[model samples]
Target: MDLISSRLLFRPMEERDRRFMRRFLSDGELTRWLPVDYPCPMEQVHLHVDRRLEHWDKHGFGTFVLEEREGEGPVGYCGLEHVTETPFIDLRYGLVQSAQGRGLAFEAAMRVVTYGFHGLQLPRIFGAAMPDNKASVAVLTKVGMRPDKRFDCYGSNLFTASVDRVAFDLKAQPVTHTGIYGAHG
Candidate 1:
């Protein structure tokens, strides 16, 4: 259950993360790539974080605040959770602008993807990002997920990417909707 790398550490999201989340989620430039509306109010940020905490209880896994090291402020958050009825565990992450472009997002996400498969014994993990959000696409791709489809999500068109461990092991292919429940065929 240890999801740690040289540059990142993952811990359950905490109330103190509100300020960092507010700053990151509210950044106009960064939010443009995200499905969230820009200028996200602090209230909405609070609500989102609270929901993530609840998700941890119900789903056994949810968003986690990413730390730079053992004793540093949170730089971002990432997690794997099966939202609502979604058959696949969804991977999500965001980093403050200062933290971007340093490969931290990919590192954090890959760690969670590994935890989802090896720790939780999940069959698959998926993530969605705006088609133009190259950074996010790169992160997913770098972690061995391939684009599975283009679809509408939260009023925006996004490219969905996923990877199945068995498929990757057998065919070495990253494109698949097969999840813990079943495949998307």
Candidate 2:
């Protein structure tokens, strides 16, 4: 899949992205609010990438690597993951510390949400962020998602946000809700 924006590119996670993922996952500042999967070894990143790719092939959607337009480099990764035991799409995103606060996350997330609704034909999408993660909460809110619930996840406080099917359809005027596969579009 390839999603192009004015300043970012959302592309399928490739093998070469493992190294960047390793670094991104290991950074203390970047992973502070995220789940502690710290010190991600290269081998594990390789395996993780492989597994994500496999899931994408089987399910037609998985987390994708977010890079800059024109090869500026990978800044982050974002995508919809199945919420265990629930019929929901959990939106996840993580970015390099250096890339924070430039509106990239919001732009990338908006595009990804568009894909989830239109491309994947999903009825709803949700995201969770640690209460302290003001930045992420802002991104979700900017995309028209609303706080639905608050609960503990991964042993920490979490905030859940969502855009229901009807609400999603009503939120974006120019953007249609009809499904459109990214790979083909």
Candidate 3:
């Protein structure tokens, strides 16, 4: 299913998206804040893409490619996934350098988190950001997630945040059905 926000389209990651994923994963500036190593190699990129595809197959929900509503190439991705070695589901998002600082991440996240709660009926969703990545933390908070804890993963210390279905129902600005459609309908 594809999720629609006001300015972006969220389509499920496909095998064909590997090319863009390679490019997205290689951006050192962007990946620096993420848990992955920068200057990602092609093999790792392929593995990452494969895992995302497998995740969807196993869980029925995974990452979504973020594109402009008017048909620009992919700018980034956002979705829910199992946090490795943990029982919690993680809310992850990232954008190309050219697309940063435009509120696109927050928009994509709000929609995805909404879908996690309403569409998938997930009990809760979690997000993790580097302690210094204020922008990412802000996006998560703005989407109604509160600080949950701090943890180490992939050698990086991360600040985790989460929102339960009850908290989301009480705090989130309800995403209107009119603005979201495609596939899942």
Candidate 4:
């Protein structure tokens, strides 16, 4: 397991997770706000899983598969990615349609953020989402990430959220409700 949450588990991506990735990566609605420039193909999803595994081995932290604890079904993914020009971890997450509105994204993200700050000792974490992704915005805010600014990305306004290392509220515990978790920033 990569990490554990109250009602979910963050684990290394495996070959078995490819099917889940296919379902998630192909969802145009979910991908609309993602930072990737092109459509995510299944082949690429498999490659991404492999890369995530390698990343874990090398960096001790990487994107993880999020699964519910009851039946251990995959619900989404969340993790920190290194931004090229900044000394910050880019917090990212995605979930299936069934998982939307359930707050699983928030729970999964809190675990990722906690690991990035408390476990990995990262100094800062940030996120970017399309301005229209209110759900994401709400989750980011709930977790204590403040809106840093708005920037252009692929011709769209991307809202930036960040938490300073020294100011991160690492003590905030996740609230699990109906398999959904809540956190700010």
Candidate 5:
């Protein structure tokens, strides 16, 4: 299934996306705050994409390749996945350098979070960002997730934020049905 926001398209990750995933994950600037080191190994990149594919197969939903609706190459990815070793589901997103500071992440994330709560009937969805990644934190906050906790993971101290169906419904704008359709929709 694919999710559509006003400016971006969210298509399910596929095996063939390895090439773009490799290049995107290799960008040190874009990935600096993420758990993985910049210029991630090709093997790790393959593993990363494979993990997304595996996640979708195992759990029925995972990250989506983010692209502009106008058909430019993929800019990044956004969606929810189970937090390893924990009983939590986390929302994540990343975008190309050229695509940052343009509200694309927020747009894609807002759509995904809405889907998580209303579409998936998830009780809560969480997000974690490095304490210094104000942009990422801001995006999560804007999506109605409140600060939940702080923890160390993958060599970085992360601040976790969360939103349950009730809080999300209170804070979120009335969802205007748009491009949402298909399996995950």
Candidate 6:
């Protein structure tokens, strides 16, 4: 899906975006909170991009690369991903060092949450951040998600939270809620 949110543009990830992905993943500082290994290699970044494409084909929704409306290239990626074997759409977002300030991550994440609720008719969307990652935790909180639990994955701790369409509608503009898929909480 293609979308413009506030100051950011959201579009699907193409193979050519591997370089952008690699750039973002290469920064240990930016990729620290991710529940993955450090120093993500370029080859691994390509594989991740491939998985993102596959996710879009199978689920009709997946990661979208984000860029500033006035800017030229990818600043980060924000969207939902299926965590492991779970049937849950785990909200996720990440930005390069260049896009760290100006609240772009929050803007991009809010857009993704809105798409999941009103665009994709998702009943609920979940997200998690390492409690130590203050930046990520702040983004999740600012997007109207609240901590629900703590769990271990990949031998790391993650604080998980969720927000549903009903809550999203009540918090965001009411007109944005569309129950095309029957309401569920």
Q: Write the per-residue lDDT of candidate 1 for residues 64-119, one digit (tens) a residue.
A: 88888755788888998775654667889988777899888977876677667766
Error of 4 at 166 (Å): 3.4
Stretches of candidate 4 exceeding 4 Å from the true structure: 84-86, 149-156, 170-185
For 1-185, candidate 3 gives per-residue lDDT tens digits of 87888778899999989999998888787798886576688889999999899999999999999998876799999999986677788898999988899888988887888788888989988888887999998998888888776433434477778899889777754545323243233
Worst 10 residues of 3 by lDDT: 176-185
User: How does candidate 6 score on lDDT?
Assistant: 0.77
Candidate 1: Cα lDDT at 53: 78
**How close is every model to the real structure, measured as TM-score?**
0.82, 0.83, 0.89, 0.80, 0.90, 0.87
Ranking by TM-score: 5, 3, 6, 2, 1, 4
Weakest 10 consecutive residues of candidate 1 by summed lDDT: 176-185
lDDT of each: 0.74, 0.74, 0.83, 0.72, 0.83, 0.77
Which candidate gets the maximum TM-score versus the true structure?
5
Candidate 4: tens digits of C-alpha lDDT, residues 22-90: 778877776877866435776786776677667667776778888777755888888887654445578
Answer with 3 or 4, whichever has the higher TM-score: 3
Let me know the TM-score candidate 1 reaches against the reference structure. 0.82
Candidate 6 lDDT score at position 120 = 82
lDDT by residue for model 2 over 55-121, one digit each (tens)? 6887788888987766678889988877545676778888887778888787677678877887778
Query: 151 in model 1: Cα distance from truth in Å?
Result: 6.9
RMSD of each: 6.6, 3.6, 2.7, 4.4, 2.8, 4.6
Evaluated at residue 97, the lDDT of candidate 6 is 82
Q: Count the backbone clashes (under 3 Å) in each candidate.
A: 0, 0, 0, 9, 0, 0
Of 4 and 5, the candidate ahead on TM-score is 5
